[model samples]
Target: MTGASPLRPDEAALREAIVHTAREMERLGINQGTSGNVSARCADGLLITPSGVPATALHEDAIVWLPLDVAADAPVLSERKPSSEWRMHRDILRARPELNAVVHTHSVAATAMAIHSRDIPAHHYMVAVAGGNSIRCAPYATFGSQALSDYAVAALQERYACLLAHHGVIAASATLSRALWIANEVEVLAKQYLLASQLGTPPLLSDDEMAEVLEKFRNYGMRGTSGNGAH
Candidate 1:
């Protein structure tokens, strides 16, 4: 997901991207087993990983498609069940019209921070990569619940990623690769923050400093990349 290149847009290609990303997340150690899910915006809806399926067992045809307009509780027509987090993904893409992909992970360090309900503050200027001075942690809610989806959408306001209290991390972006990249970056930041806290509290960048960083980030990092797929 780290800016290798933009993916091709055809449904066939996007399906492959979903499978590739799911496995890559596991391979990169950001996710394990069936704990994480991936999705991409497609015509009128989204293509998502299937529920209860490990990335190692996932295949392109196992991917599920759901219309964005459907209620989270509604039955889906696909042969396979979409990820339990489909509601969160659907709400995010619907709310953030510009974002085309979503990656959810139970990465160890990030979820460790989330278990404490801590936000990732601007302990590093790279915090701006998430489109904010901090990565907010949404209040705890049962997985797959509509309440959880609501909190996640609000926490992600003006940001590409957020942590779920007692749950995991969610990273969304304009493309599948960028979403995967942001998901990885969130884990890195969380790990650094935890390491720094061992010294009795990490120094934080001032709001003014973070503002400057955010300004510089507007024309840099993942946002600066340009390509044809998932603009």
Candidate 2:
């Protein structure tokens, strides 16, 4: 038998954050249908949106909690089935203790580039906000498969965000809001990259230039910083 466990107490706010992020994706045009999912780490496991549930209709209690230490073959610990992409969220949360949340979406421009299996190079300094010189596209795999999860994890090794070739995007951070914000930035960068490509191969930053920006990111980007989110 698999090693799934039970939920813990007072995770009400995390449930709300997941629900809000799901719907926010819709509002922000980062996703459509129920094609995206969000999750936040909790005391016992992680809280995720229910499978196939529309974000507008999502309610806090409908969220599913999967214990961190659970074995893969175990029945899910909650009544509702979790998102099909739960494995990536689960793996990401397990692998990255510094990140408390994960946001995945089939955001338009990003997905368009991913359809070509192209990575977003450092055409703009804002790419550093993802903690990298470029956003790599994890090689394609069937959605919801363990292979896809593995590919995403590897692509995001030193970065908080990455695209899934022909699939979508993934962003994670210390907080749900920050994760969502980064997802939006990735989408904007994707849009920019796509637009610039129409003219010619876009100019890209040198590794040294991107390194300078990555350093700026640690002290910038987040709202409370002196640069006021400029990095």
Top of the candidates by TM-score: 2
The C-alpha stretches of model 2 lying farther than 4 A from their native spots are 1-10, 221-228
The residue-by-residue lDDT of candidate 2 on 1-231, one tens digit each, is: 222224455577678778889889999999889898999888858888879988888899888878877556657634558888889999999998888899999999999999999989999998987778899999999998899999999998988899999999999888888888889989999999989989999999999998887776665644221232672
lDDT of 1 by residue, 1-231 (tens): 111122435988999999999999998899999898999988878888889999999998888888778674455734458898889999999999999999999999999999999999999987878888899999999999899999999999999999999999999999898888889989999989999989979999999999888876664544643331211
How far out, in Å, is residue 27 in model 1? 1.1
Candidate with maximal lDDT: 1
lDDT of 1 at 162: 97
Model 2: ten consecutive residues of lowest lDDT: 222-231
Pairs with backbone N, CA or C atoms under 3 Å apart (clashes), candidate 2: none
lDDT of residue 72 for candidate 1: 43
Residue 23, model 2, lDDT: 88
TM-score against truth, every candidate = 0.91, 0.92
